[model samples]
Target: MNHFTICASKNDTHDIEEGILDTLAQGFVVEKNDSSYLLKSKGLFKRHQGAIHVIADNTDPDYFAKNMPGMMSFYHNIPFEDEQLKELVMIQISVFNTVIAVEMDKEITDEQMQLLIKLLSSIGGVGFLPDGTLLDQQGLVIVYPNGESGPSNFRPHACTKMINVQEATSAQGEARKNNTIAFLVEKGIPYVASLPQLPSVEDCAFKRQEDIAKRAVALLIAIQFACDVAQSGNIEDSREFFLNMLHKYNVQQFLTDNEKSFLQAQYPDAQYPDAQEAVSIAWQYEAYWTLIWALGFVETLEFPDDVCDCDYAIQVVSSCETFEQFYAQIAMRSKEEILDEADKIYRLHWACVNSRINGQAAPLALNESVVMERRRALFWMIGYRNEQWDTMSMDT
Candidate 1:
């Protein structure tokens, strides 16, 4: 059976009217594979159904048809939001322009232009017209006006400067050029061009800067621990005196009032948030990468805390496996301690990080899983941190 008859309305005394209303209400049921709404039946009422249709997909191609409004409402009724989406559009443009610039004078297709407009519309404000004309926030005339025929000109590159209102188009272009040079400088770590060696990680320029910053944070935290040990006065007057001496020498200018307070008051029990701690880390990172070209070695061999008690991996170790075990295995230290003992741990941990960076660190007792576990443990111990992509300038 291709189709069936039905009553269109119950109130209508006329059989024809009743059948018409029922048939419309019963609509069509689309097959799952078609990825379309309504199975649109064929037969007697087909002509009438087409005539009375109110939400036909052909009416507005702009409206995405895959998931109808009713279907979307089931998930959430709200529409899209966010300014980052606009930035992403710009990033995409950059990627496109770079490719085109290298691939010769290849122009974006009509479909590409439509997609760009759709993406820009989702981001809100000014967008490109079907013919590549730019629209302002009020959807009025902008730098490149639109006409009935289409856009007057095609300058996809201009879109990059439109979002960055802070900088003029020329300024933005110049900034991008500078950023590219800076990126190169970062990659050529231990040197800006041929001079001024930059002590940073071995990778892209951004990665190098990030690695230096983390090392700086690690050194700062270790300095704080030394300060704590000295303040306790239990170790030795000489030990306390030496710690204070190093503190004055290394971390004075970089330490904020709040950080100093934390050192004086919170010491071991204190909880430090990520971004705030990153500030201090950034300070040391700047100095370390700039001044110190040659870095020391760091080694770590993460093992279960109870590894000493048993030859096999301990069940308790599954819950509280620590990196100190790795340090102990290599450093010849039998005892274990918290991360606060960074001064004592740095010798081994530094060796681990340095060796890994230099490809000098060799695999120990464990397989890849154990290696990954230990790497994570060492990350915290070495104050490993990821760089924010948005923060660093991109090569224009």
Candidate 2:
């Protein structure tokens, strides 16, 4: 059987090709043929096929993009003493923008496989097997951006397990839940086992409490303005009211792209928002709620089985006149507290996504939109991936 490996890289095609040649030079005589390479073993007897075809291109790896969250979740389960390295791998995986295809005419030997992995890894590449296993250049070692690597115990076909929450019998449902929890726990991710658990405050890297408070206030003003303009059909008075609030809070610089776009669409000659746009703008309330919770405005974020109370949400922000007053009322939760919630929501969000992919109702009464928006807020609060507010990825 022919063997194939898909690799993702930050390097261009030429550099990756050179890397392949350099890596294989010790074991084989390599000849470059355009994008392909031909190899002959230096040993007396060849162990496998002598020819390899490579195709490198500048394109997003669709499989990686679609399954990234699941892959990262898998990696996150692996234990790493260096939290920074763990995070670095996540960030590097998120930004890989190129793909390389390595093909052999026959199944590769174990030795040949290691060579291929080494070549890819030398160029800061990630490998994906046909069975959905992700690997570093050193076979199973998870490589860091700075050339350090850690052993990985990730198993193949782990991502293919699926459960239909609505169809299973009570016994089967319990089994599935137990299996899922066990799997996560064995992988060193215990946060998903129960109600969200906070890490120690010392372990968290949090934005300044005051900064979080300011952001919450700014989001509140922007989202509320959007709600009003949507309710008033984008009238001049509504625009004036929003502008006045922005001036009052001096939060113009903090508006997210979505908020700015919604406002811009309401310019004097612009059209009123369509139903989709209006709903999107309104849903920012959930994100706003999460920020307030982080800022200690909300007592606790109840399970997201329902949308947050709009009237109560409005009351929370309106109670404070200025940003300073809102900051004053803030008893900002510890970074550990917010991250714990974020981690729990992440797993819950994954279940929701898994259900959708399987054509079933969202499991555990999860409101998919609420879960997603809440995650978006929590992720932003913790600066997950250091992404901008509008571009932040809520990878399950």
How good is model 2 by TM-score?
0.59
- Writing each residue's lDDT as its tens digit, candidate 1 over 41-102 gives 33354221212111222333233222222221211211213223333223323222100000
Tens digits of per-residue lDDT for model 2, 314-358: 787678777777667878787656766776677777767656655
Q: Residue 73 CA error for candidate 2 (Å)?
A: 9.9
Q: Candidates' lDDT values, in order?
A: 0.28, 0.63
TM-score of predicted structure 1: 0.23
CA RMSD per model (angstroms): 21.8, 11.3
Among the numbered candidates, top TM-score falls to 2
